[model samples]
Target: MVESESTTKVNVLMVGTGEYTTGYVGGGAADSDKGAGVVALTMFDLRRRNKVSRVGMCGVNGKKFAGIRSHMQKNIGDVYNDMDLTCETFPEDTVVDPLAYEVAAKAFYPGDVAIIFTPDDTHFAIAMNCIQRGMHVMVTKPIVQTLADHQKLAALAHENNVLVGVEVHKRLDPFYADARDRARSNLGDFQYMYAYMSQPKHQLETFKAWAGKSSDISYYLNSHHVDWSEWTLAGMARPVRVTATGSSGVAQSRSMNTEDSITLTVQWENLNDQKTLGCAVYTSSWAAPKSDVHSQQRFFYMGSSGEINVDQAHRGCTVATDAAGFASVNPLFMKYTPTNGMFSGQGSYGVRSFENFIDACCAVNAGTAQPRDFDDGSLATVHTTMQGTAILEAGRMSLDMDGRPMDIQYDGNDHEPIAIVPHVFTG
Candidate 1:
């Protein structure tokens, strides 16, 4: 697929229209942090910048389209000086079709793109359909629940020559980027790493529909740290073994069968020498009480030479008011503040993550860059993030089997390292 012009813009199809797309969760805007959501807002901003063409949104329930559009118009469009937030819809009105994404995928061609922001379980199916249709795809993290599905998508994307990127936006964080750089240069070999990320309990209410029935807090929150760890130790170490444990009661008390908090202890073998190994402990929870911030995130990383600590929750910026009490703000993810009467979150890493993917797609279409060049770590493609998927799947399996530890077998027999789970039985 060759772009006839250098300035050609690719059409985008948004695969989900819930909180992340329209922020109309539970019949109103999100109760917690995100009021207008990220995906749709960012895409519209990209459109304004002339990087994207026509945009379309797909949802299983067509009844919610009117509300979603109104929500977008009121929150996004009006807030940003009546920005054009127009997009097509699938399933039409009065039709509830879970396979609506298939119909939406037909509108885009080989060089176009699709963003999958649906549940953890549906990512694989939607992304596979997009890839088969010769469209580049970007799926939200924890990409999929199974390592098998991750591998299949990777192979299919390669065969079809489409880019498949996992939306691990944390990699774009400035502090996180510095930490990763230090770990690679001055921090020496990987020694021990610990990361904790959590959200308020109300988030459970927002995701109650699928909290335990479809996926767990680990897959939802732990995905952040796991992907960060995998990215930090990219060429230095690889996870060889994993053991997972969980704490319950908080979610269960609310009729949710998911763990209140989950922790994974992964053993990483030194990439240079298989004989040497390091340990990484990653913990995540959605049971946090209401705090100054919506999410409590921090990490401690140690290497042979030195260590680094990051408290992402407190960026040294806090505010207090009579109406809202005390709260911490993070403009790094989504800068809601406008400049010159226009939406200006272009500097935010969260927005840059999506923009980076689109830029790569444009370059690939122009024949200036190959799909494999993205595997070199500009973005978290399926090929680059295979270790993260392997570790997460192994952790889930470990929890399923009564905390029994599982091993991550790396198949170097292929062109690059391919993570393999011996016998992954998901719960």
Candidate 2:
């Protein structure tokens, strides 16, 4: 810890006040576990532990701040002891400006942090501005839509000597982590992998704006497994080609102008042997029926010697209630229930992900850690997730070209790797 009192806590500026941050989705607080949202609640709890300094929030619509604050006060602050839901809001809560984040982002200095939970398309511009001003940033998944933008952000972050991370919290899952370790050790050469992740159809409304216009379901849900796959097999294999197919009519029927589901078949070249190859199928959708679990996630991996199977959705824990009906709960992600009337979610991976970033920021500010320190395949650093972006964008191009195969080209190998243009569809 820093001995100087002035440099003790890192200031934070939250860039979004929507579902993931406020849980006030579609006008009112969501009835799900995230009634008060994940990012805001975790930051508030971090401040209580003296890890964060000033906390501020920003949104495009200023009128919603009142409802957001009221919702949070009831769902979060009022529930936890001495939990204050007070923070600065950009645009003065009177002006409705789309560029309010630009104003809120100016309050933090170099070494401070900005946790961006905004839409996918807006991430590049906002994150660029923050990095230019020398502020550490942590953005939501599918960091950016294009590989060009991802590489640009990585370069800018490195030039500014700032920490930029993607919030891929699945790495914090013990089961997933164990699987990754085993894959590296016991699971011989990569052979085949199949992964699936989906959420209820209602999430379409949650992401209505950018559902089809800005990005697609592959970029939205498939990013988790793609990153997980890459993270698990980073040094063992590299993705070479990808062919994508999608099922439509469902989302188009709903007037969303997007695909109902997408499947990407990626070809991998094992690093050890030039001729040996591996294949992976990654499927994602936001149009599944409401099951006992809020999301259905599972994966099966096979190697030259052994194989592994993981069903992340069913954890052998189920609960039924009069109002909410029956559902399977996964408290490992976010333990919402308070202990002793105070926020006690330290063990949860969702909260731990934020805490890890905050602690890294503190360490960096204390002159004990460098940006490359986190590139050790632990956290989802910008550099480590470039290939995932490549695969997702390649899938998009494949869809635009009627399921044609696309190639993922890399400029360099592991040392300072640069992603070449993806989506080279020629069918």
TM-score of each: 0.95, 0.95
Tell me the tens digit of each residue's lDDT in model 1 across 303-368.
989999999888988888998899998998888878877898889987899999999999888778
The pairs that clash in candidate 1 are: none
Q: What lDDT does each candidate get?
A: 0.86, 0.85
In the range 1-427, model 2's lDDT, one tens digit per residue, is 2132235678889998888898998789764556768999999988888998788998898888888888898889788997877799987777899898888876667788899988888999999998888888999998998989999999998898788999999999988888998999998999999999997888888788889999889998999999898899888888878899998886887799998899999998888846599999999998998888878999999999899998888878788999889988888888887898877878999999999999988887787888878999868999888889888888888888887788777655652335534454358
Instruction: Please state the error at residue 254 of candidate 2 in Å.
Output: 1.6
Off by over 4 Å in 1: 1-7, 412-427
